[model samples]
Target: MRLNPYGEDPVRLATSLTTSPPLTAEELTARCVGAGVVLEQAATADDLAEVNVFLGRWLRVVEASNPQARAALLNELLAESSAYPRLTDHAGDGWHIHYRDYGLPVARLLRALISVGTALHLTGRGMHRLSRCELTECRNPFADFSRGGQQRYCSPTCANRDAVRRHRAKRALAS
Candidate 1:
């Protein structure tokens, strides 16, 4: 059975992009491909700029505090980059779903992918599951797929840093 391509992968890809944006079209395309996107067009500088704009808007959705506000923001993104859902086997990976039409530019593809993926990720997991790391110094956005649904830090490093800080604070309080 074909896995849902519109789920975790896109959200993770968006997080990665937001954390460290690509500097060039080549780098952007490489990152997308690395994240499981199959590109059909040659990426251009214009595409990179367009994607940066989309990412800016997407980051707003990530930073939104309330569910209603987040939904409104995401709906706006979907309206901007939406197409009729179509079934495609362009890559012969499998007969899967595409929320966009073929031949769209790379930026448009990314817009659609991120919008749909975020929606799926929130609904499938939980709306409260997506958040920035709780570590005061690291505000990286993360999609929590943890079994307990309590993930706060972006990675183990952040978790460790926070733990060390907490330990130091306790020791100081004892002194």
Candidate 2:
């Protein structure tokens, strides 16, 4: 069965790219493919540049502190990359939904995927689930898909670091 690609995967891909961006068009294509995005067009140098621009805007949605602000930012992105939704069985994969029409270039595809994926993530989970890591120094964005929706750190290492810091602070205060 084909899984929905418009949820956790795209958000994770966005976070991964934002944290450590792809240095080349080939790298970007590989990263997207690894994230389950099938690129129909060849990734060009200009596509990489355009995608970086989109990523900058996409990160704003992640960094927005309030739901209204996040929604507004996301709406702006949707407006910029808006396309009618359609169903397709491309790649012989079972019928699945796509937010953008077919035959789009790689850069445009990223915009639609990231924007629509983000919308689905926030609406399906909770707007609060998308956030930056709580560790002060590590500002990576993450989409919490855990059962409780209470994730704070981007990774276990950051969580451990924050826990240790908190423990040391408490001990220092007790002394």
Write down the lDDT that model 1 would get.
0.90
| Candidate 2 C-alpha error for residue 81, in Å | 1.6
Off by over 4 Å in 2: none
lDDT per residue as tens, model 2, 1-175: 7777776787888888888989999999898888889889778899889989999999899889899999999999988885888888887878889888788888888888889989999999899988989899998888898999999999999999999999999999999
* Top model number, lDDT: 1
lDDT of each: 0.90, 0.88
Winner by TM-score: 1
The residue-by-residue lDDT of candidate 1 on 45-68, one tens digit each, is 999999888988998888889999
Consecutive 10-residue window with the lowest summed lDDT within model 2: 1-10
What clash pairs does model 1 have?
Answer: none
